[model samples]
Target: MHDASAIPDAPTASSPRAGHAKAVAACGLTTALTWPIHDILDPVNTVMLFLLTVVLVATRWGRGPAVLASFLSVGLFDFFYVPPRWSFAVSDIQYLLTFAVMLTVALIIGHLTIGLRQRADEANASAKRSQALYTLASHLAGAMSIENVRQHSASFAATQLHAELSLWVCAPDNTLVPATPDDAALPHQAGPDVARVMHMVHHEHKGVASHQLADSGQLVIALPLTGSTRSRGVLLLSPLRAHDPTLDRHRPLLDAVTSLVATAIERLHFVEVAHQHQIEANGERLRNSILSALSHDIRTPLTALYGLADTLTLIQPPLPDRAQEMSSAIRDQAMRLNRMVSNLLDMARLQRGKDAGQLPLRLEWQPIEEVIGASIQMLGMALQDHAVQVHLRSDLPLVHIDAVLMERVFGNLIENAAKYSPAGSAIHINAEVQGDTLEVRINNDGAGFPPDRLQEVFNLFERGMPESTVPGVGLGLAICRAIIEAHCGRIEACNPAEGGAQVRFTLPLGTPPTIEPESEGEDRT
Candidate 1:
């Protein structure tokens, strides 16, 4: 921040500040020159010359000087220019009338001249300030970032008011940090006290906080950068040498400055957000395009490969032991690859469904246990090594869900549990009624998920052990989350205290249609 000093004033600024001495000198000079004109010129003509002197002083100097010149002209006219020269006494009473008229005319001309000059100076100052404001708005409109905004603002402040400035922008959490990254400290290098004040300014959402340094009487102002939607931050202006009256007078200019700055900053903020969103949107479209194209392209040949391998073992005359094992291995790898491809296709489909604002659901009221059983049957051999346990309360309520999609959810979770857990470990499935929803939990006694990555595991391609040689590309949990959310349910993963990972999901228990019993008196078909 720079030191305080006022900007250069224009030409008219000097007029109103004229001293009494200058006014007296002008009057004295007029009288001395008129001493020579006393004998040569008529007394009335001499009075006219004195009146003109008063007008010049008023226009050049200001109101007070003009009034002083007015009085001096009258007295000098009475003693030196009247009939009884060098004396205050008058020869003819008519000359007294001349003196009275001269004084009255001089005062009126001086007063009017001074008022007109002051008005003209005021208008010029206002126009200059308005032009400065217009220039500032132009610069701010083209500002690329907060740094650019602060730079232009500081330059304007220096040029217009001779002040120093810095901008502190608000973070999402309502904390203030320096808008300029070049600032070596956070909100304030000045300390926590100043930081608190800056935070307060941002929180208050309106008005400026000001203080005058006792030593230098320099004005420091903290102005809120309030945008249309929110308060963006604070703009700090400091070390203004202008006194209280000047600040009060220029307060509107400062407000307009902050308003312009706030508008520019918010525009930049949204532009950055829009640019980022566009990039993400482009990337997502590309990923989905690749996934859809590859999945469809590979599925045909992949199915043929799996069938050929399965046929090798089923032939009437089996191949040699080594050949048989190789065929089995080939079949197993193809199945794994097929599952991966199916996952990619499903992911792309779900993404498209979400963009269309709804998932494709053939929803019905069905027993959740049926979906669980179907999922286990579908993954028959995969869960052979793990003991599967299903614990459902006898009074479980029917849930409204897409039966096929729910089955996929259970299957993905069960298979994921088996893949991540040690062989022969029990994968626990439990369901119970909790309030208006049915809560279900799938637990596996593996090392559990990484404590820090429990939530992240559900993000696409975020594996629990990223570097570990897991046989998955980490799509199962993400798919599960998308399905559960589409059903208007909630899902979360956590490590249970029992030393294993658990995925819990809840499905809403809607009002199921009543099932009427068969009427005993029904007519025969």
Candidate 2:
């Protein structure tokens, strides 16, 4: 919450009774000044002089004073300047009509003059309001941060509305809190009942005159700072007086102020978002460079280590059985490490290609069954303990894909299935045609994926169980997703009703090359 409590009040108008007293004094002065010239000028001229006085009073003192001046002008004219002077009676009956005409004319002139003056005052107020908003916009345009927005907007509110403000900006978590806790205004006044205020702001998207919400009985108006896309925060404005009439009177200005504040806040939000993304992009680029370089450097050593370990197992006398077993284990571990490094290198290449708006895929028309079978054969000893099943139609169509990458996807899925499920658990692969797409599913019998995090499992380095004893980095599924999406396919993870983790992906089906029959006539020719 950002609070501006040190603002000074603007100048105000004089009291009503004092203003009316001045209007009466002006009328008395008018009668005294016009008395000396009554005989010198015609009575008609005298009546015109009184009407002029009424107009002046109406222009200066507003409606109430104008009304008082109108009645006083008539009484003073009949008693002092007209026939049967110093009395309410008029000797010539023609003068009675004069009295009626003079009084009626005076009241009408006063009313119209006062009304015209009011409209003038309203127009001036509107001009002043426009100028103030323009000044505020100028100040906010230069604001670079939320704090700058707060200080400039609060200063504007203080000078124009004669009120202080508290700004509560929305946090990234979608929670509304004070812009700065240390700067909260009237801790006893606004902070405690914030929950109620924020609820009205977030849901209703308007200001609420929450009169009874304050602890010290002060009124707090909660104005929602709503931007184009969402609510930015709440701006709490406190009027100068409790139950102040001007609170409602100045509501339009208050709302205008809220809109300006919301706009500034929104601009700052997007700027921060862009800055964060830039930082992350820089970090990601640097990380990929390091990983790619390291993968290339490490791959050669790992291949040499695997070959050396394999050669040791086939030594002349074949070493001892214990030595032979150790060599085999060393060979397997080196192979696994080499594959991991290769995956890292592949991920770097894919990321670079993605940055260039495409993937480096070597596409060809290949049988889906052949790719799946090749993947299974590549993971031979890894799948020895697990039962693997493949269910594909005899007439399954050829698919356009990057055979190497697709094989990697299948290999990763099958290896993950074998690693995650209990030893001897069955891994199932099935495929079917749906519309113009072929859907393939790989499932395993195991403690299924965490239900809540099904989609997050495919994010780079994200795993179903982060702390599990699985001995592989979580790149397999992520790489699979990247490769599949490059082929214009979609992938999803779920738990089947039979209780196991399942990953399904879809590839579009299109016309394949027609196979020509090599008939006997062609063979003889």
Candidate 3:
């Protein structure tokens, strides 16, 4: 790697720098050799030789060495090449001007040359580091597992960082462990408290920490392995020289290495998560298929059982009072079971990937009030104890929807309210045309949803009161959301200001048809 800091600082007289000595000696030797040529050439031409020496020193080294050569060149020229040879005094005032011009011109040329060299060195170093970073990133992108990340990261750190390297991964239990267990015999052993520091860095997700190693007392740096959102782990580098000046200069390269490693680790993490999700999805699909098949088989027998129970009450002779009551109970339980079966079947249909995308729905313009009344009647026994109040705007527009599915939405919401609310508490249904859409709300005067769990109520198998005697696997609200969204609408649940649970949904109010009157009796002839 090219290090821009390798260019020497300004030379001081107290410090015996080798470059300064070399510059001064080269200029002095050239001046001595030019002494023999002094009688053969003009003194003005001798100044050219000294200027050439200064330029060479400046290009090869830097400003410190170039400055030394400049002063030495002028001194040698005045001592030997001037008219009064072997002396500092000048024979003519004109020669004094020559010495001044020679010194000034040499210093200026040396200064410019040194600046150009320094800039070129900096550009070259930047390019080299950029290439290194690009190469590391490419390799990291191909990394498929945490082990691959560990190997690539460690190798780059060892080669480019010039320090002993180790990657510490934050385990699921929050313990810090070596990225590769087998590579534990590396140079530095971390302190026991290093995990605490790693945890702090990962949680803060900012800044690097320097710690003293336990066994060797060597300084090591711990930088957070930051993904796009969270921290992955910590990168620990050891055996960095104490008070090293160049370490700060290479910080950007170190940061690039951290970014590449963090990204690789995060990618591997999500890949594992996706694989697990796919497996779970496959299992869920199988379970739904089995439930759907069983529900289909049971529906026929359940219908028969309900019919036979009702038939018992219709015997030629009037049945006994107890028998009539038993038949009513049987019918009610049968209806409840059938509703559950229908919900499961609806879930299965909605969850079918190809069906949701390709299956057509039976949709038409219909009155929302009709769907609401049908849902209430379907749940007659269930909501018999609860009072239902309907508040609808007078000019409610017709909504374009699949009537059967929209009825299901109202049924689920009303049934959920009836089940959760106290007996005889009123369930309120309200609707109005708001702009180009119709918004409907169903609220129950009962204990509202638990704090901050309004959205969780719509997740499959999630319950508002999980431990309560309420009989549901929590698929109702999820189904309702799916149906409403399929109609290009939105649904939301919230706690009302007056203490109750409110579920509101909306659907587009499409343009209604207009009928025209026929002309009076024109076609009678």
Q: Which pairs clash inside model 3?
A: none
Give the per-residue lDDT of model 1 (tens digit) for 254-305. Answer: 8999999999999999999999999998898888889999999999999999
Total residue pair clashes for candidate 2? 3
Q: Output the number of the lDDT-best candidate.
A: 2
Weakest 10 consecutive residues of candidate 2 by summed lDDT = 1-10
Order the candidate numbers by TM-score, best to worst.
Answer: 1, 2, 3
Local error of candidate 1 at 438, Å?
2.4
Model 3's alpha-carbon lDDT is 0.80
Off by over 4 Å in 3: 1-139, 142-148, 165-239, 243-246, 353-359, 513-525
lDDT per residue, candidate 2, 303-347, as tens digits?
999999999998897799889999999999999999899889988
Error of 2 at 385 (Å): 3.5
CA-RMSD of model 3:
7.5
**Tens digits of per-residue lDDT for model 3 on 1-525?**
233322233346654476788898889789778887788887767889889999998998678888889888888888877768789988799887787888899999999998899889789767665776777788889988778888776666655565666787777886667788744544455677665676777788765545464455555567888888677888877644544444445777778788889999889888889999999888878977987898899889989987887787687686789988998789777877888888888887877733447335688889889989998897777888898999987778778899998989999999999889999899999998888889999999879888788889987778998898889888899889888888889999999898999999989887887647778976865
lDDT-based ranking, best first?
A: 2, 1, 3
Candidate 2 segments exceeding 4 Å error: 1-14, 24-46, 71-93, 134-176, 182-201, 204-238, 250-268, 303-332, 513-521
